[model samples]
Target: MRWSLTVLAVMVTTGCTGLELLVYPSDVLRIPEDTLHNLTLSLTFNTTQAFDAALNRSGSVLVVRVVPDEEWKLKIVNTPVQFTAQEVTEAACKTVMVSGYYWGHTRLSFYLTVNHVDDQFLPGVLLRDDVVVVVDRSAKLLDSFFIMGVTLFLICNTVNMGCQLDLKLIWQVLRKPVGPVCGFLSQFAFMPGVGEAPVTGCLHTTSLTISMFQFSYLIGWLIFEDPLQRLGLFTLGCCPGGILSNFITLLFSGDLNLSVTMTFISTLSAMGMMPLWMYTLGTSLTSENNYMKVPFANLAISLVSLTVPTGIGMFIKYKRPRWAEISNRLIKPITVLILVLFGAIGAYSSYKAFLMMNGAMLLAGLIITVAGYAFGAIMSKLCCLKRDKIIAISIETAFQNAGVCFIVLKLSLPTPERYPIMGSKDGHQASSVKFMKNVTFGPIGLRTSLWG
Candidate 1:
């Protein structure tokens, strides 16, 4: 009998120790378990009622609300999930894991609650919480493809030497001394108070020249209310000329060599001019906090990329002129096709923003183009340039580099605070398209009619 009692006592002691080990300490709960239980029960009743009221009032909530628990693992998933308040409550009580994703910014809130009736021994604790997860997978994918296509285009354009610059002739023009001076004066003299001379005298000149006109008009007239829009317009105006000027000059039977030389010089000048102009003008226009950060790395990359292709083209011309000629002929159609594809892809990605565009944007774009042509003509005539040079000057002065303008806008403009609206990226794309359209159908067409 004594042995049996001793064994029973040992068993009871072991069982009590095991129970103590399993039970969480009161300190871990941050309060006594009984007190916590009572508080949790009260909170659960209030929270459930509040959530039900919110559901009825709003009709639907896109954001995911999770109950925080010590063991529960909350995460964001690409795939979307839908659940009612009751369903969420049940899941909170039963599940240890929850995952969800939403499109826009989400608001998160947490409240602790407990089920008193269902869980008698250990109540079902629910720490209700809302979580926000922004998924940029689609945007990332589109950006990747866009970058890849641009890289390919750059490689192909370089290999073909589509806009090969002649160093020997450039050297000859520089040696003349008067030629460089005259070119510099012609570019810088017309625009005053705008510190630092225009660096890009190529394709972008016309757009930029017109943009200067627009900037003056906006500041003097106050056409746009938003400072961001005004800033964007100013940036477009200030962008340097591009190689497109050479092509346009060629099409018009203008001085192609002079245009090409000017383009090369202007592009080289951009390394300094772009940053200087942006900083000086940008500071005056907006608060220092909102000042646009120039992408110097991107600028350097652009210069290097263009230079490599140009160098390759020059090499081909020197070593194999006949082959280079054949390649140019072959590449022209391919280049056109690639451009079309790029346009289509760009349009597809930013269609929503394009659709949101207003008449004011289109009008602004048109004004920019028309003003460029008018100013270029006046400047060329004033300079007393010959017919071919005059045409070249006019073309150079009128057409701004849409690519540069687009890049500046992309880098500098602010992202939309809200989703599904025309943000910085979309705004730039839409504006670029509009500018290109005006150049193609408006000024270029008119120039062709008169000169071609």
Candidate 2:
């Protein structure tokens, strides 16, 4: 019995010794995409004699292969290398250098096999795995050009718009104040509701009885899983009309005066209403660190960008009628040019923002923009406003001052969270522009008169 047991132990030990073992280094390295990187893999085996025996069986050489899941995605240079026994092993580790190039984020695994025995592979290491690629040289140049070009266009457009403005007509509209009041309600009241509205009967649940407020909170929580995203949407909804509305109004032959007036009033009102909304709804979405500080500087900039060139144009119109007339005639061509720049240069600068769009945010943004347009149109009609004024109000209500939104985001969130919100804003802007051009403006061609 003792002899049989001893033979069995020897057989088990022999079976265990027959297997080969390899240990990889515990460190991980992260490299950029589309860049060359040298990866050093150190291989450690159980015993030198075992290594020698395996090498001898494999013609005095061992092979190291890169085993990537997507073979085509990872390009390995100097792979499947053969190392002879004479290659130096420092500190009991045989180091192999592998060079590779990858344009995207992926994991690359390495494996070593000798004497028909397969050793375990290293866990795949990821390179350049972020959804938004790093901004390189070309993007920076495009962005700078975009900024300068858009600024020039806006100044020219706003000045031309100012030439068309009649102070008497503006005062008359303000004195009556019906159209402006409706626009204010649409921007502050209905728009916020559209942005913060909750889902009802989402799960089709019968037993659960929840309040409207609770359901709203629950829906917001689910839709914006990230706090920063929720803040972005909320701030976007609360933002006042931007200067872009004046251009859109001019394009459609709406009341440019009403558009400019509404933009100015809304921007001013934001100092108060923005704080109120942020204090009430914004407090619930994020921590105290994100507490909304009324961005007075951005608001001042918005006011200056809108008013100064406009005031200059008003002066030019008051002093030089022919010059004003010439500038006024150029409005359509310049408006077209500005729109084109928004599409072309804006796209180049904001392509990274496009990559971060997702289904939930897309749906919400569409809903808000469409609903704002519908609300503005309805409210203006109820207020007994003219068609031109209706067009102005609708455009104003639909497009928010995204610049302010961006400033607020920069102030409130960290780098990681800011990216997704900016992306959401960019996607929303692109979709809104498409909706306006194809659905709204295409049906009704540009009207000749500035005011109906």
Candidate 3:
């Protein structure tokens, strides 16, 4: 019981350690007058602009009035209306127009100056140039509800789910999975929208991502009695299918060692292969693919991100089995919790973004995205590999590198917050972004299902 308690505490603290909300000043007001200055004015707007400032409107004043969370008005001039604040925030920003105009200073510019609302010197902790404050009363409240509700749901689900996944039993049953699942969602939750999510945006994503990705498949060999530890070509290609595809092959005539070996190879092959695969895939997709530069540097970063730490983890797990057990019991679940939180937050943000965009278009996009997976699956099977090989290759083919795509989007839409955002279905549009979670792709081996 005490060990469980310790594990639980570690999970909560570690999972949330990286979360924060950034507030900033508008472009007009963002320029800090002096390093010693404290008061800063920020702007948030929600209307279309006749002319564009993002293009280069030299003489523009962005005006924002400071009111209590529920009562505030911010005016941005010359930017697209998309709740694009001039400030930077990983979390969502919330804004509403108490009153404004289609033309004039309110529409032409956003201007703000700092003043103490409460006599006391405004604490720097609350204000930073690096991060921007996306304060909206409506967004705050609604987001509060969103956050509180999801958090409670997650907590309940995690506990209940954890209880069912008998660690010992699963460890015994799982034949040393090469890693975790990788598919469109498994592979491309953060990947570009060439395909659709396996599930809807409204999902307990982490729960699904973890269970489905990690242990859904297994790989065993005729040559080796054990279902894992193969350093071969098949494993190179298939280990990514995780346990799901791995075991699915056992039903058919499958070579477990090849898949395992292939997995080891595939995971490492990112050095040369990821670039080659992505480039070839992108070029085939469309002219836009050619236009889109694959950030090989970032891809390299991601490969290192997963490989190094996990290798260390495995080493420790092997060298000190007890410590490995302790760490796995703690780190793996915590990692899952963090990922679940990431998925839920991303889902909420995506949902909020969906609400803001044309509903029909986004839905169409979703359908097309999901359909991409089906297309990939069909293409994989048609290639004429064995059934087991099909599973490995299918996973390899279906999984898109989402983390890379999102990074590209962020790079492209660096200052998108400057646009005027439409009113959102969830009261505060920006609030949904508060937990703009990071996408960590690659294989993640975490426990799922308590003891049903």
Candidate 4:
């Protein structure tokens, strides 16, 4: 048991660290002119075009040097190339490389283009200029989104804002007449490892942050939640944790039936109320003057993606009790693995963003994360909540569902050219320009929001 506990702690810690490591901002490196020049030369020089005899058709192929300066050691055996060749009938040094690196002050890119010649007997050498690389706005915008989410999460965490669910009441309910019944009912919806954790890591760090904040809020709500809210929160929406908690409780408490029933009730209520409550109050940004409402589409996606899988797991749990038990047992291990994977992806995306920009985003993210926890704790105490309730609220307020936030970001802002195309005079034709312009833009990848 001690080893198990230790392992869980380590897993959680590692996941958190991974989450923190990923998520970078845009505009951190500069593209070098020399790199571009080299890329251009490599593409045009190492490549060739031929008129086929057997097929009676024209074709072109390229073999590029693997490295810029390492002519001997870095040469590749055979690098296949299949770019539009008609544009590159030139052998000049006007080609460019599109790759960028952040280790140095100057970043580099590659480009290649064709030079048109009118004479029947053209010159032996051809030269042309093509392809321009610039920092795209979408990349910056994505940085902003991530920064905003992190900022809001920190603020909420600092202010102690989030769901204030009551735990003591829950425990009390477990000891009540319907506890066992609730526990039994909860079994219907409880699955094991599969849940929202993985999704949280995909688009934004906010989802994970927000969830922790919610947990904090629940702890806080234990003391301050209104009687009505308290009752509403206890009912289960038939999810994994519901039955698992109830089953665990039965080991210690004689009132197994009461524990079971209460668990069921809590699970059901949590699911039903989660959407409504989140829509109403679960956000970092809200105001009567103006507000950014999460679109219906994103909400639907989250519910479907997260809840349905759990529901299926629940169904499996009941249909195949032994299988369910086995699956449930695997939850701890799987949880660790999935979380690690999520952290890896999120961290990688974040790191890429970071390379593009300065350390401002990282600093901002840290500040916000800290602020979220602080505020959540304060709010819990001010609202007359107990320590446990405060803990829950703080967790919820601090962690935003990155997956949900990513979805929301994609729907709201989408591509940088979305506005240009939508605002353009050409109805659909605007898309082409918008897409082209977007390529030059930086990565506008999604990150988690701190609030609902």
Candidate 5:
């Protein structure tokens, strides 16, 4: 029995390795023993056409398509590559490679055209860009394992706490008219600001900024802007407070019981609110044929993932307070270790995206963090809450469930066919990491607000 228990513990700790191997098979790196020489293709495009109105009479955008021989199994190398008119103009031509799996002679074809903003095609524009690529099937299985393991460990740590849900205390707080009112305003009304606003009906500067950001994204989509990117930003704004709110509350020596209770309330409330917010704000963003598919299963899973561990923690607190205290003490160091590991893995894997990330991304992260903290404080102050409760509310309002938002992005946004076209997967992953890093700024803001 002892041996079995030990085995279970080890399996639980190392499950991510198994998951990685299953998801990213070694066959990705293995070439068939009987394979012949590798295959490559070269292609060209002309960028000078962008300057010629007579040639580009149809559109400003360039489209390139490659057609390989039906007998050959071909794959594009370094897919989702970005190219600009300036790069093409400077180089005069661009080349891409395609790798063939089978040992046989194959033929290749190219179709190039220019597209206008209205999706009209322009003919007679020759782009002088040619490239061929050989596909490298080498997969980064270790990186995958590391990222998944770190995420699991972080979630486990966040949930592995004693739930001190004081029913009587929660009831007393809610029974007061101010408590319910404050909770409603914090979740629904208080938000970050872009600029100034009249302080009336919860529409302060911070809240106005947040609202404008969300609304502008929706409006942008309506006006045929980058719809997928705008959808991602809108979803981030819609997420409710995260489980990390409880940890921040504890860190600031605020009311642990109240924090836990509010987290529970908000999470349960999100089940309804999330879908409602998405539907209300995103109706114009989707077509009737391609309506946004909400990941109800993932939402349910997130709720279960949070509640089950919290219930266990509550049991520990009630039955084993000393053990709970020890577990809590251990979490701090473990969290730091996990963060360091995450940073290394993220930096290594996403170095290119990090370089490509612009000032707009940093500004977005900063605004999300600052606005959450500032508006939350304003709301709490308006409610006339005491210092401790005010601190709890502020933290709760500022820290959103970025994990849940990421999941939604992964599951819902950008269909499989459009993944490569939009580079949605990589874009979201980078943005999610940036958003999480920026979220750390909230606790600092909270601490500063408390001191002030």
Candidate 6:
């Protein structure tokens, strides 16, 4: 009878020793996903006496941790919270902070325990909250700056590129159709094949380029285990040459006329090619392809952006030859300044995204750019094109219109799949830019240019 009575007394004492903490207001918290700074939660004991009991039996410190935690998600800012028995008695409530990293919903549990080694008291996790982290629709400072800078740069640089074009050379090159044909093959055929992206139309003739494309497609099919990786790579390869290519071409003293011409052709063709590839190949990547639109408005804007500035420059060249010459001299320096300015800003703004990228994705981006240059150079040489033409074709082939990819991914994929691909594409865009010193090409000498 004495043993039973003692056992019952111990059991009652053990049950009463567990400390429980309660949250005030509610057990659920709704906060913005962008809350990386801190969020204060009001913590209180389950009963008024619980705090005093904890201090006497457990200790003065309470350790807290988040369950199912990630660095990109909810995390405790500091370690175990410290307190004194007198402080607990005097304070109204205790507060703790948790950081919200990304957009997602999770049931985060705050486990609390005493920081004592005496084993006199046991701690219980009584704080379980349903955290709903919604997306922050607020406009960031860097985003606005990036947009404004890019827009201003594009308008100025495109006009500058147009001033470099020699209409007679463009006409002559078009008439012969050699360099344009090579560029066409490099962009549409060879690149897509290299990326294992499906082409919109079938080629009628058999040639080495065709064989290379098929071979590359075969390689990509066999090698890439993840379909999403193929989709991202293929998307990058399938895009037309961006305006940045023409800027790059001018800096390198490549055939500006050829580069401009090829850029126009590929971009115009992209209206049809982009949709076709997305519809067919996109289905293979994910079923969400059905909901994807062609973004025709963006394509039209691109075309207009390319042509309007160039048209103005061409008029300037025709009517005021002196102004054109002066402008050409000034344009290269301005281009270099713009590149340097944006490169620094971009690096600063995108450091977090870069941190999220894996090493394999970064290495793959480099390989894709290098392979594009190789294909363009080899194909141009095989076609017996001039050095300037070779350089132009290579620049055009290697640089994809990342803006187009951004729109495509944004509109096409769901949020879960979209962000990762977008990040990978951003990494690719950063890697693909091959900055070079201004050099000599044909009659133009850029030895005195800023980069030189």
lDDT of 5 by residue, 1-452 (tens): 00000000000111211110001111112233123322222222222333343233322344445454442345545332223433333333344444444322223334444334223444423222121112212335665676568557746665564444445676677677464456545664444112222334442333444455233243223322344444554555556665667766766766666666666676677777667655654443343333455566655665676677777777776788777778777765665565566656656653433433445544554555566666667767887877777777777766666656555654544322232212334344223323332222222222221111
Clashes of 3: 66
Residue-pair clashes per candidate: 10, 0, 66, 117, 25, 0
Model 5 lDDT on a 0 to 1 scale: 0.46
The reply for model 1, stretches above 4 Å from the true place, is 1-137, 140-143, 162-165, 172-221, 243-254, 331-335, 386-392, 398-452
The per-residue C-alpha lDDT of model 5 at residue 420 equals: 25
Which prediction has the highest TM-score against the true structure? 6
- lDDT of prediction 1: 0.43
Residues 49-81 of candidate 2 have per-residue lDDT tens digits of 565655544434445565545454445666654
Off by over 4 Å in 3: 1-292, 322-339, 346-351, 357-372, 379-396, 409-452
Query: Which is superior by TM-score, 4 or 5?
Result: 5
Q: Candidate 3 lDDT, tens digit per residue, 1-452?
A: 00000000000111111112212323223211111212222222221331232124323322233322222222332222122223311123534322221100111122132212212323222211221223211233445565565445444433322322333433432354322223333232222222212333433243234323221111112121211111011112221222223222333334433333333344444445434433432222222311324455765554454334444545554566666556434533553564466456645543433223333323323332344345445544555444554454444433333444444433322121443222233222232222111111112111110100
Which regions of candidate 6 fall more than 4 Å away from where they truly are? 1-64, 67-69, 72-75, 78-96, 100-138, 193-226, 288-290, 416-452
Provide the RMSD of all predictions against the true structure, rounded to 1 decimal.
17.6, 13.4, 19.8, 20.0, 15.9, 12.9
- Candidate 4 per-residue lDDT, tens place, 386-410, comes to 4544444343333333333333323
- TM-score, every prediction: 0.52, 0.64, 0.33, 0.35, 0.56, 0.67
* Candidate 4, superposed: residue stretches over 4 Å from native: 1-93, 101-294, 312-330, 345-351, 383-388, 411-452
Ranking the candidates on lDDT from highest down gives: 6, 2, 5, 1, 3, 4
Sort the candidates on TM-score, descending order.
Answer: 6, 2, 5, 1, 4, 3
- By TM-score, the better pick of 4 and 6 is 6
